[model samples]
Target: MSVWLENAIARANSTSDWLSPIRSVSLAALKDTPWPTRKTEAWRYTSLKSLERATLSPSPSVNQDTPEQIDGFESFNLVFRNGEFDLDSLTQPLPAGLMISYLPTASEEMKQASLDEFSQIKPGRHLFGLINDVLAQHVVRIEVAEGVSISQAIRITSLIGLNSESHTRVFVKLNKGASLTVSEHYQGNVESLNTGFVEYDICAEAKLEHYRFALQTDKAISLGGCHFKLGERADLNSTLVGFGSDLSRVDTDIIYDGEFATAKLNAFYLLDGKELFDLHATVEHAVPNCTTLENVRGIVADRAKAVFNGRIHIHRHAQKTLAELNNRNLLLSDKAEINTKPELEIYADDVRCAHGATVAEIDKHALYYLESRGISRSKAQVMLNFGFINELIDQMPNQVLAEWIRPQIRNRFAEMEVTR
Candidate 1:
């Protein structure tokens, strides 16, 4: 085992909490699981050398860090600064049918409910996820009552301080026929590490609109996972946006457990400097008549690297399943690199599934068209890159978020110009 994993195991063994029994299971599993290397199929393109000898500072000096402000986005915000939950979030009045509980101080009923639901949805395959399970002491659970529609979105933000390491987890559930929206945001810089994971259970006929933004950059190492299990006729729409950092890896999985359920996932990552970002997304069709649509894109520049692995799996009994995945990439510089794999594994003969990937540079025809219209070459490049990602950004159901993120992407394109 690498020094980092050994240290993690030690640290995990030192803690005792209300969830100790559950943590022990994961801690044991983490110990037995081999450290990944170039030969590991799941981690072939990503390296963990940065973590092998790393020293962690578990606690941060008191600082009132907060999430970035977005104009006109009204949300009930749950903020974690250096992995410490903000008490103000609990003081705010919540809308009916919404319940938020912090595990450490939860009531008996809430704690019992959380005990039953925690760690049940996310698969045990992720290394960082197992680390998160063992080290995360503070847990948050959010639930929407049956048949209720929540108009306002619930936002969860994790802000990591410099030179600190933190782990956090969240569990959310939507009962039968309920509707809700959730937004998760993480930001850290200056040589910090963070692991955050979330799981959602959507019951029959429920609909959930979700967004997760891993916006940390420049020296931050962030790892996380988001998993969902859908019930009969359930609908899920999810968007994940990633910005490259020193090392950033995120895994997302969607499981269709009931017939007629549908899921749509749209994701993208933008990288600059010498940063690295890896995203692994999986969609599982375990029941019949399910549908899935996934689209992922990336832009790499300035010697940065981006990795994508998109997989769609259809079980043998999942007849009439429809799934498709498309991945596209644009490299801004000759030194920039992208590794993409789109896979479709179908066990059912009647399933309709297709997967494809493409990697290329800026479209010269489009660039020439813009340049001929009197736009500067550099400006044309920025415009072209912006247009490449804007299609997916514009599809964001929340126009406010789309408008908020567009300018940032445009600025990155200009600052990190790539020479083909």
Candidate 2:
């Protein structure tokens, strides 16, 4: 075990809560879990050296950090400044049918139910996830009532400061026939460590639109996950956009628990300098008559590195399932590296599933065609790279978010200054 894990175990053992039973299980499992290395299949291409060497200490309870604002996107904001929850930042009087409560102030009934649901959707295969299960202090629960549609989205933002180590958790439940839109944002450019995880339970006929932005860069080390469980006839649409950091890794899992459900996921990333980003996704078709569509793309420049492992599992009972995953990456520098693996595990003969991955440089022919015009070579290079990821950005359902992110992606290209 790494020194970090040892300290985490000690810290987790030092505290006890009403959910101690649940935390105990995680703490025990964490003690038995060994530190991951390059030999670990799930972490084969991503290194945790940055985390192991990071200093773990108590962070300030509050900071002046504020969440990012979207001009046209109206949302109820919940901010976590440093490792502490900023309850004052929440836009209160949450509309009817919506409830937001934190661990420290949850009602007895909420606490009881939270114990049973915690970690139920997220698989235990993740090493950092287990640590999150144990060390997370800022646990927030959000629920939407049955048959209600929340038009205004709820935004959860975590702002980390320099040399801080923090863990945060979110649990969202969309009851039967409920509809909601939620976004998770993590923005920190300083050197720090953070673990943020969220789980969603979408019940029968419910719908959820989810977005996750891990935009932290530079020496920030962020490990997080978003896990979803879809029930009968449920619907889920999720979008993820990220910029690379020293050790930025995220795991996303989509599980179909009931029949006739649908999930669509799209993710894109941009890496520059020595930053590294790793994305691991798994889709579980545990029932019949389900459908899944996933698209992932990335651009790596300079000495940056990116890793993608996407898997779609079709169980034996999941007949009539349609699942497909496609991952494509662009490496603009000779020293830049990308490792992509798209996998399909189908035990049902009646299922249709496909997975593929490709990593390559920008098309020279396209560059030449653009240069044939009056476009400079450098300008042409940025255009080609931008065009590759713009396809996915254009697919974002929220035009407000898409427009906000488009210029940021352009600014990233300018900073990268990647050349042929």
Root-mean-square deviation (CA) per prediction: 1.1, 1.2
TM-score for candidate 1: 0.98
Candidate 2's residue-wise lDDT over 111-191, tens digit each?
A: 898999999999998888998888887789999999999999988899999888778999999999999999899999887
Per-residue alpha-carbon lDDT of candidate 1 for residues 305-418, written as tens digits (9 for 90 to 100):
999999898989999999989999999989999999899888999988888999999988988999999999989999888889999998999999889988988888888786
Please state the error at residue 119 of candidate 1 in Å. Answer: 1.2
Residue 139, candidate 1: alpha-carbon lDDT: 91
TM-score of 2: 0.98
- For model 1, the stretches where C-alpha displacement exceeds 4 angstroms are none
TM-score against truth, every candidate: 0.98, 0.98
